[model samples]
Target: MSDGANLRGRFITFEGGEGVGKSTQIRLLESRLRAAGLDVVVTREPGGSQRAETIREYILGGGARALGPMAEALLFSAARIDHIDSLIRPALQAGKWVLCDRFADSTRAYQGANGKLGDDVMQALEQVTLAGVRPDLTLVLDMPPAIGLQRAASRRAAGAPADRFESEGLGFHARLRKAFHQIANAEPRRCVIVNADRTAPEVGADIFRIVDERLGDAAPAPAITR
Candidate 1:
């Protein structure tokens, strides 16, 4: 296809503490983008590419629970490297909008905020892993930690297990939530704070509005239905 056939892809990521509904909103946004007849690629991290997915399984399974924050950061960085090379970059280069459920912001929040890893270390990891491939927009779904934890708990099936991050104490989750807002405040231009402690449709609508405003002509035609 000619260059005129597709616009340069937009890299958009959704970030927040656990159960803020990044997955659901990504799906909604993907549907809306598809409805508008755009090529949208939906993915997530610390998985997306094969290696990353394997890393995700280990990390989220709590198998890596004993590892220190710095160690965990290194693992995530390694996964991100594969994900970028194998999936994210190629999709973007092909002029497909990439909507990610979580990105680097997740690392900064989950590990740097509550864990031993510091901001300097996290930033360095990002520099190495991202290789300058930053998201065009990041929508942070914000809500109370307690509420989010409850929601996350309710999602589990009977006898199911909680992930390492999800099993963190209330204090840790609270700190994680604060870190995300800090990130948004630090980068107001690239990040939008969405109140996610509401109904699915309400939160989704707010997200779509922010996306529409930032993306302008590039966003889907007509406003998002939900």
Candidate 2:
């Protein structure tokens, strides 16, 4: 039910800081879509494809941190290129709704905002990497950085150190939240800000409603009986 009805698939990306429960909600939404008799492909950025997963390991393992933000952004873009080529594009062409955990917006928020990369640079990278393919809808889960970090910490295994981004201080996360808000504000039609402080079911219900309102009408109609 994408605006690009000719593409035969809808792309929905979830954006938020760490511990916003994107993975959980993606699974819930996937199940709902399956129950609704739609083919769905759930994937994640920086790791969706086999080659991209290699990049994900290196970047998340803190190997790319010292290389600086610009380098990190380049690496993420490289991964995304492979991800789209190897997985996302094929599935969409096959008429499967694609639910991606994170996408270019994360790069815009994390690298562009925190790394001080200008909008021009970000736009250039997006143009090269995306090549006209973009999510039909983006869900930005909103919550305080303090609460989100605490939730992130609680979910981690004992003595398991934080990943590159998660290890950052509260100020970094606060800025991340602000950046996501700015993205939603700038693109009201393509992005929706959903409060993440509530229970999962509550959040899921709201998400479903939004999805239904936006894309449900475009779902393929059922066949009539003879």
Listed in order, each prediction's TM-score against the native is 0.92, 0.95
Misplaced by over 4 Å in model 1 are 1-7, 219-226
Per-residue accuracy of model 1 over 1-226 as CA lDDT, tens digit each: 1132233678999999988888899998888778877788999998998889999998998777787888888888899889888888888777788999899998898888878587788888987888878899999999998998889999999888888888889989888988999999999999999999999899988887787788757654444343
Instruction: Give the TM-score (vs. native) of candidate 2.
Output: 0.95
Please report how far candidate 1 places residue 65 from its true position, in Å. Answer: 1.8
Best by lDDT: 2
Model 2 misplacement above 4 A: 1-6, 221-226
Query: Which 10 residues in a row give candidate 2 its minimum summed lDDT?
Result: 217-226
Clashes of 2: 0
> How many pairs of residues collide in each model?
0, 0
Candidate 2 colliding pairs:
none
